[model samples]
Target: MTIQAAFTLIINTLGPLQGNREAANIAHIVIEHITGMGRMDRVIYKDKLLSPAQEEQLQQALNALLKHEPVQYVTGKAWFYGLEFTVNRNVLIPRPETEELVEWIVKDTHTPVKILDIGTGSGAIPIALKKDLPAATVWSVDVSAGALEVASQNATQLNLNVHFEQIDILDTTATHSLPLFDIIVSNPPYICESEQKDMEEQVIAYEPRIALFVPDNDALLFYRQIGLLAKEKLVPGGLLYFEINEAFGKEVVALLEKQGFKNVILKQDLYTKDRMVRGEN
Candidate 1:
């Protein structure tokens, strides 16, 4: 079948599940993954047709999408901070708001400094930060080995030198011996368990649960834990950054302030949701 024909079939099938805009976007991404052709290339080859093998692959991706699997997972890659990173069911797909957090970190790099990214799935935070601020020493930690594997692979593919370690942030006694940092950042799981029922089925069902949830009553768990760690592991005046849940921006800022972090600031995303927070120890 022609590429155009296959694209129409897939888009028509999945389009209604999410929306026309998302379906069209996913269709383009799937075609690019299977044929390695961008929008222009797809247009150029519209009449050229997809081979049988390519058609089969496209059908499989469509099935996954119809089941509410994220297009990023369907394509095995997602773009963050304008860079591509590998993603799977094990890691949370990097989002645009996280890019703002990376921007916040890079902007503060007036000099070479030690940096740490907590819950660094896909190593997106550290990799993007390092790509822009090459002089900084960057390290990332995650409790899941599978997540760390994806993060490490992303670092290698991007040729960004970042140290990935498998360690839980809540296990403070062990992390206490780790080296100090000039900037500690995280896009930690701030979603409360009760919120899961309200999330899109694709997200709640397909994305890694451990990477997306905290106790229903303790939504600020990671922020509080990481905030304390920043106090202990960061130099005096060190910076702390977080990609927080929009609903808890005020609470997160308060958590940092209660821990004595100064200059606590909450920044919004392109949509004007309070999504990023920064403070100094």
Candidate 2:
């Protein structure tokens, strides 16, 4: 069958499980990944049929989507801050809220600064920051080696210089002697365990659990620990930025304040819900 024909058929088949738009998007993603034939190419070659191997690969991709897998995980790539990064089950897919966090960091800095991104995942935050600042030293950390490998591959592919380490933030003593940074940022897992039921199936089911949930009661666990680390690691007057749960913005501000961070400010997302906090240590 022709590429357009396959797209329509696959969308129709998967539309019932998810929404029509999501199904159609998945179809297009599968087509592009399987055949390396983008939307424009398919439009230009509307009369052409998929080769037999291409047809089989597209079918497999559709099957994976039908199982409720995320398109990013299925294709092993996601776009963040206008750049493409490799993604998989090993890490959380970068979110729009985190983009705002990066923006805040970029805007707050005055000169060449050293930046440390905790729980870097696909290295989206550091990579975007480096791409924007060009002169800053960007360092990133993640506990999962699998996630770090994907992040390293993305850095190489994007031709951006980023220093990545597989060190757990909770194990900060192992990483002593690192240079004091000018800015410290994180979009660490802030989702309380109780909030899992409300998340979309594609996220809860397909994204890495290690990168999503905190304890049920101590939702501020990462913020608190990172705040302490920031106290020890950040130079006086250095900035610390976080992408927080809208539900816990006030709580995060309080945590930072308790840790002696000053000028704590909470900023709302595009939806006007409290989504980010920045303070100085």
Candidate 3:
């Protein structure tokens, strides 16, 4: 099949399921990943025929897309903070809001300081921070071995020298072993179980639940635990940053304040919804 034929097949197959714009996006992502054809190349070589192996790959990708898997997961790649990352079912795909959270850290932080990332789902946060703040030392921890494996590979591939370890942030004993840090950031599990009904089908079905959902009753579980940990592990003026659920902006600010963190601020993302919160120890 020609390149245009393949594109049409994918777009037509997914249009009804995901809508026209999204279907076009998925087609572009899968085609570029498999054939390495950029937008111009796709247009320039619209008549170029796909080789047998390429056709097979496209077929497989189309099958997955039909199931409503995210294009990032289907491609095994995602872009975050201008860096490309390897993603899988084991790791959550990095989101634009999370990138905003990272940018906030880049702006507020100036000195080279030790940083700890509570959940290392694709190593996107720490790796991007390390790239922007090249002098800073970064360590990231996660409870899932599979997620750590993916994160470690990303760190090695990017040559960023990030420390990836399997540490459950929920475990006080394990967390105590971590050294003090000047900045601690997390995009931890903030989606409440009760909110699952409202989330996208692809996210609910394909993304790792352990990295996304919190018990409805204890929606601030990670913020509370990580905040307390920060109190113990952060330096006198160290900062704690979190990508939070918009619904709990005031609640998170309050939790940080009650934990004795000062200068607590709830910031919104590009959409102007409360998406990030910062506190100083």
Report lDDT (Cα) of residue 149, candidate 2.
Answer: 91
Q: What TM-score, over all chains together, does every model reach?
A: 0.97, 0.97, 0.98
**Number of the predicted model whose lDDT against the real structure is largest:** 3
Q: Indicate the residue-level lDDT of 124 in model 3.
A: 97
For residues 1-281, what per-residue lDDT tens digits would candidate 1 score against the true structure? Answer: 88898788887898777778887888888888999888998898898878889988988998888888898998999999989999999899988888888887787789999999999888899999999999889999999999999999999999999988888889977697679999999888888888877889989888898989989878888998888899999999999988989999899998899999999999999999999999998
Off by over 4 Å in 3: none
C-alpha positional error of residue 112 in candidate 3 after TM-score superposition, expressed in Å: 0.9
Local accuracy by lDDT, each model:
0.89, 0.88, 0.94
TM-score of 2: 0.97
Ranking by lDDT: 3, 1, 2
User: Runs in model 1 with CA error above 4 Å?
Assistant: none
Q: Compare candidates 1 and 3 on TM-score and give the better one.
A: 3
Cα-lDDT of candidate 1: 0.89
Error of 2 at 11 (Å): 1.3
